[model samples]
Target chain A: MVMDLHVSLPRGLTLANPVIAASGTFGFGPEYSRYVDIGSLGAVSVKGVSPEPWLGNPPPRVWETPMGLLNSIGLQNPGMEVFVRDDLPFLREKGATVIVNIIGHTVDEYARVASRMQGEAGVAALEVNISCPNIKEGGMSFGHDPEQAYQVTRAVRQATDLPVMVKLSPNVTSPALIAQAVEQAGADMISAINTVVGLAIDVEHRRPALGGTTGGLSGPAIKPIALRVVYDVAQSVSIPIIGMGGIASAADVLEFLLAGASAVMVGTVTFQHPGRMQQIIAELPQVLSRGGFRGVSGAVGQALPAASRPQTRGGDL
Target chain B: MAGQQFHDGQVDARIVRREEVARDHVELILESPALARAVPGQFAHILTPGMLRRPVSFSRIEPDSGRVGLLFQVVGEGTAWLANCQEGERLDILGPLGHGFAPPDPSRPWCLVGGGVGIPPLYSAAAQWRESAPDVIIGARTREWVLMQKDFEQLGLGVRVTTDDGSWGQAGTVIGPLQEWLEGHADGQVFSCGPTPMLAAVASACRGRAAAQVALEQRMGCGIGACLACVVPARGQTQMEYRRVCTEGPVFLAEELIW
Candidate 1:
């Protein structure tokens, strides 16, 4: 019997599987092609790109925590022009759907980037990253407020006809509100829980571990939080949800699927195992077969236990 | 480029050897036949159970005995646990990952400098450069942080030490003493592995005097080229081209690096 776990997204975007490489962790996609077959996976999310070139943070940008790692990489990347010229061409040669993660300081920046990729041949989708703290704007994070999320999403949506995915930060109080707001503002899909804000203390140096003092937390420590956020947002948003955080194994991917994500992005887990995407893709058939599921859509939201009373916690749905 | 073997729950052997100089750091002598495949500057991915793989550079590979020795300090949770590993216990190590330091010149009077934990790789390079009897400079933040002085002395080479608090050797950073040596020894080759600032200072000190190479310490995920996590900026490159500390090098030419 042939095993099948195909999952589909809107605008005729169909995937043989539901696993995608989270942005940043999988550098432009082709690098992993040397070790694993890139085209077999659902899709490849490229590194985060900006309107202008970014230097990232200083040395010691990452610190390993108990179960995860904290990184204040400051979204280091080549500007859009370099990415299109030097990197994108290489990715285009690889037979994988390339999802570009775009970050911006302002709505105009977001729209400007989207407009550039509007009719690009090889580009599949655009992931709007509004979770970055504006360096010139006194550390204000763009995703914390719904108005900002709506404006950024709306601007990009208007500029490009391509599918738009909004990557949300779990540091906010209400992930559902942000999810719903972006959905209403015209995000084709949503990727939940970028990373929770956290810091690590260096006992030897008697100071904060990360160079940036504070950083975004990824890896196993944020898995449960990511699952909760994905579950909460899935209920509120009509758009397809891309759940991510600490997804490692095939079982972890299934957890996100049952939690209501149409697709799952493997983040910190990929760091632990660079060849993880292929391992996850290879295991999906057996996992789905064991669960008696015909396809991935049948598995979506299937494991959500009878929606219990919403917890009284602040910002929880 | 070699083959990889899968050992399931193998009792990977480990032994604690007395430090030739300092007590804060210990050398774990690995007995795995797999370790024979190690490269000069490549490191071992030590498995310490609760923590992820902690990268420790190969201080020396006893080629005949298949004994691969790693010099490490009691730094984080992984190193702290590694410091306590007793003889006969096994360590889960996936090894010799990344490009090691470049081969040293046998003709010149080379300078080998290390500060604190970064001193590990230099020990191996020093052993390799024994024929040349190179000049050495070792430093730390304080006297207590100073590691492996006696080992440097045993090598019978010119050894200099510096501590910020002035508890040992010189009263300033390694650059001050290094600059003094470079001023007189016009044709020496410089090799160093230490804190970023200290190595940068060494690079700046030897700017036009000598060719300097430094081993960079960046937080790594896979000590292989696979994960782009351990990237160090390269000089003269736009888009901030980086060399993977694991794959490209934990060691690089000082002039080629942006640091």
Candidate 2:
């Protein structure tokens, strides 16, 4: 039987499907254009961009350990000007709704980037990245604090007419607190569970493998954590939530939706397979039909009862 | 501008050729028509036991036969599993990826050097530099790891071999042999591939002698440019200043690289 899998965002942006190329995983959209038709999917959140270009961390920046990948890329990008000047045109030509991810060192930096991108054509939304390790703030992360998340969200919300999305970091103690703070500060949506903080040892070198000493761990290793955060944040705020962290298949996407994510984002899996975005987009309908659902939204937050989820260690899987 | 396909668990072909050169490192000539079109320094992502594609460079290309040769060391689980691969067994591979060796010029006398696994690409450079048969130098911990000596000699070129343990050839580092060679005959370009320290030493050794190019190895996700995983600080570029070993080069001008 044919099932309707179309999913729409809270703002006016509607998608043909529910699969989004998570920001930082999928570069400026066109990089994957060769592997798959970009227009065939829902939307793409371009790589994280800051006010100025980032050189990123030093060598040995990424490491793979037991079904997961850890990276300390530090949001390396070509800055806002070049992204709008050189990158946006290509993404626009690809014909897919482009979600621009903006990050900054301070609140004014966030507003400046948002204001510049405010009236830009073809940009579907602005995703504010508040999860970076603040070098100036004595190693305290931006997303770990609710007030900081609110300040960044409010600043971007006030600066741009475009729908503002505040992406949350999983390393935070209370993702719900941060999510609620953003909702109160007028954030349109929330993308939960950026890579959790982790590290690896190079045994041979007798030191941390990543040049940054610690990195954001993604892939299957963080899938359960992502699911839990999405579930918690969904219960905390009335705003829409885009769940992500190590999504590998359509089944994985279903897990996020059932956990209360309005939509889902694909990350680490894309690194293993560049063409995975299209495969997930094509497979979502089959997943809906198999579950006896008529549409993708029907699966959102349809988790089993507390007695049914079968308490497995640290909350629901 | 043809379309590209992305699917996991897809193996195009898996006919293996048994060509054992040295201990621990064997030259596997795999049957893959798709990868034969790969350029000089590009690599293929071979499936390791636990990990996905542990990146390996294409040491040489035999287009007529659609066979690509890979020279690898059995250091970790990936290489050990790869080393045990049989002649008829099918191995999952993602192809002709990353960047390859830069195009060689016939007018130039290219001097190629390698240490251990780095010696692989020099074979390809030697095959391409047929006219001058560019001077080639190779070094290893001992005689056991020194490979392709016969292959390099068969190409009718000057070949120098060095062993840190003094078990073979010039009983010293590759730069020692190269220094002796340069003291007498001094008119050729330099091209090297190997471990970072050896390349750095080669870069330092040839400080005022001639131009040198080296291939860098880095941890990678997508062998394509999309992931931005394998990046090295370039010597004299700005902004997008770092060179992606996967795209910009596994190979680069020795002077233009930070190391």
Candidate 3:
């Protein structure tokens, strides 16, 4: 029996499967390739890159919570130039579709980074990161502010020929409005929930656990919130959605797909099992078949109706 | 290149034996043939039921028996659970990961310094550096806290033990003895693993004399480099670079570290 796992967004960016490595959680490829076969996965969403290299946050950058991991890594990368020169060719050689995740402090910075990758031959898509909570400037601000979101999305959309994916944060009150605004600004697709803003404390020392003071919450703790945001934004935007936040198992991926995501990126839990990406991908086929879906694309939004009162379900249609 | 059975992949291991080596600290001997290829300073990551893997250094590895030993202190809930493991209980493990120490140059004198729980990896290295007749130095709060003193002697390395309260071999910090010894072998090389202050002291003593390497410990998430959690500051041209303690090193050249 022939099975099709391919799912794609606009501009013909087709994922060989519905499971791609989440950005930052999977550095371009080398880090994870040491554990599993990078070529076997659908795509690799590399770490976020800026115009210049980012030094990231200080030590004690992470604190393990019950069923979750809080991190304030501040998007550390060797910069766009080094990424293209040192990292890209390696992933391209390994037969992996590389999704370059880019971040910036201003709208111009986003376009500048996008423009830098304009002629890159190996990149499959660009993931515009406007929802990182660890950075002090222009990260979570763009995702929360509708105007900034639209401007950055439109500017980067105009800067490059590759399909654009906007990674959103769950810190905002009305993420669906921001999602609609970006969709209007030509964002080809959306990735919902870039970790909820959170913090932990050391009672004895009276000090914050993370050196950054506050970090993004992920793992099973943020799964429900991620699902809600993805469901809300999925009804508002016509663009394809990539759901994330605390997804570990194949069943979790199927839940996100039914909640209205074309695909799901696995994060936090990947830290638990070194080869979790392959494990999730291997089990996805069985999950789809058991759920009575022919393929991954067909399973998307299976549980959500288009014209009904989704507000009763905690979102609007 | 000890890449014979050394793997970066995860495998299952069983707790073949368990022992309490010091106060609040325990060692678990695991039966995993894959460990035979693991080098001295590399670490093994122990997986729990739901939490992230707890990374512990390879205290001992018997190639012929295909068994490995892990030494760790029960500092948290995750490790507290590990401390109570019954013999024959299976554990999911991923490692022989991370860059270990570079081999000792046979021509130069070798020294191994350890502090508290940091003694394990350096002890593993000292066992291999037997020909150099390396100096083995240990530091702790009291005599009971000092570990593996006899083991170093058994390996034919000269032992120097110290405690903060004058309860052991010396009446000062372990680095004190190492400093006085360093006065003689000005060009010798040293290998060490320990808490931050001990490493900082070693870094200071090896300043212009001995070439040194120190294995670092950090709170880790993935054990692999992906999570970017276990990172330490490294000396760079302009500023400091955050190097992964799990991937770039559990062991590093003292000169490159930002300490």
Candidate 4:
């Protein structure tokens, strides 16, 4: 209570702690609510939602890697329509700040999904999932290209009054460039980074273990890469950054914050234990007090030296 | 068992009895009332030593005594640690997860086929329908690998055993006798739980003739529906979309299975 874990991001989305349940891992708050008190968390990003109910990838969709997991789930979700009718109400009842993650195969699909959620009562913000394949341009992911990232982010930003946080994929060469493009396109916040692409094969069967052949890797293996992405992107944009990708412990939260993330999201680590967020939240004060920080925001972007700080970006950042 | 595909209640279950079937396979009887809620095909997500929970199927349930049985194969470091756990020790289990098998009509011949590690759940399914005298086929690599045959036989259910090396009742796979039965029988249904190859063979044999439900195995992340790790390709009304094997089913209608 004395540590002041409160973090006020763009669009007035406030959190009780820096550790929020990442999308896909939390599943709109209902799944983990039974094991832990979900209402106490900073925020919970619901699973990636599409225009229609997506069936996702075939069997063997998930493969286990060393200290990580590769999943080609293909963003399996109940469509935006069904989510609004059935799932969103329960999330609202939980009283936790909800970040609805939306994805699309086309720019119109992203915009349409965003617009449909504009009038929703419980949603705190929209996290655009540009990692989805851009069907308009031969199935290349929108987040991989700078122009597509900007166009998709702009479409979603224009479609909704809610704060837009673009969740960028780490597959790109320099996430800083994409972060700059989204910030220029009116993105209120940046959630870097999404899963890194990876592949796993079944040696005994002499074939791919995952039905999708390849998948997005998430977990402890990608933590360093994600930290670098957050560090690089923080200097390039003034927008609040919600950092994630294998964040599991209180110490991990501190690392992301110091690496220039205003708040952090716990993604794949929750799969191991559902109530892990509670432990991290409880232990966060000890971590902050140990590091001589007064609050969660006190640690954001502290790793960057004075000379490395952005010269032009001057607001609350 | 919790009346849905996903439930958050993680039960602390104590081991009441431990039966070692083979070198790596162990059958443990856990005492938990929440387990009484579980049906035949449903499984429990048990916390192992690793970073993820292990999915173990429910072998039997004594509802009145508030006890359930679990079958696990110690194939790795995580399960090996779990298998070594002695009686009176406790396990954190999230149950009664996933959809259980719904038995076909009793009037029709119910063929319960199980191979290798898949034999456990079939025992529970057979015990439930024992009054109807279901035909239980237990298949293994050899007679030494065959398990729960006596359990099924004690219920007076017709038991047929098959082994690959022909060290048991029938030679070759269980599908041989299963195919023979499916071809002659008019009113019958097949419920299979076994290796992927066995299930696939049964599926192909029973295709349009015998209605079947097969239990699938997958490497799961969160035993709850949150992680889309446990999924199988199942055809919906319009398209062949992926269905979550963990949530929508561990048991799916054989017709909808892609392979």
Best by lDDT: 3
Tens-place lDDT digits, model 3, residues A2-55? 457888779999888988889988876887787767887888899999999888
Considering only N, C-alpha and C atoms within 3 Å, which residue pairs clash in candidate 3?
A: none
Q: What residue pairs are clashing in model 2?
A: B40-B101, B41-B99, B41-B100, B41-B101, B42-B99, B42-B100
Q: Write the per-residue lDDT of candidate 4 for residues B102-155, one digit (tens) a residue.
A: 866978888899999899998988887777777888899988788899899899
Model 4 regions more than 4 Å off: A132-140, A307-317, B1-8, B183-185
Off by over 4 Å in 3: A305-317, B1-8
Q: What is the lDDT of residue A248 in candidate 2?
A: 80
Query: Which residue pairs collide, candidate 1?
Result: B41-B100
C-alpha positional error of residue B79 in candidate 3 after TM-score superposition, expressed in Å:
1.1
- lDDT per residue for candidate 2 within A35-87, as digits (tens), equals 66788778889888878887777777788878788887767787999999998
Assess each prediction's global lDDT (C-alpha) against the native. 0.75, 0.78, 0.85, 0.83
- The 10-residue segment of model 2 chain B with minimum total lDDT is B1-10
Q: Please identify model 2 stretches exceeding 4 Å from their true place.
A: A133-140, A304-317, B1-11, B18-20, B49-52, B185-187, B236-240
Q: Worst lDDT window (10 residues) for model 3 chain A?
A: A308-317
**Comparison by DockQ, 1 against 2, better one:** 2
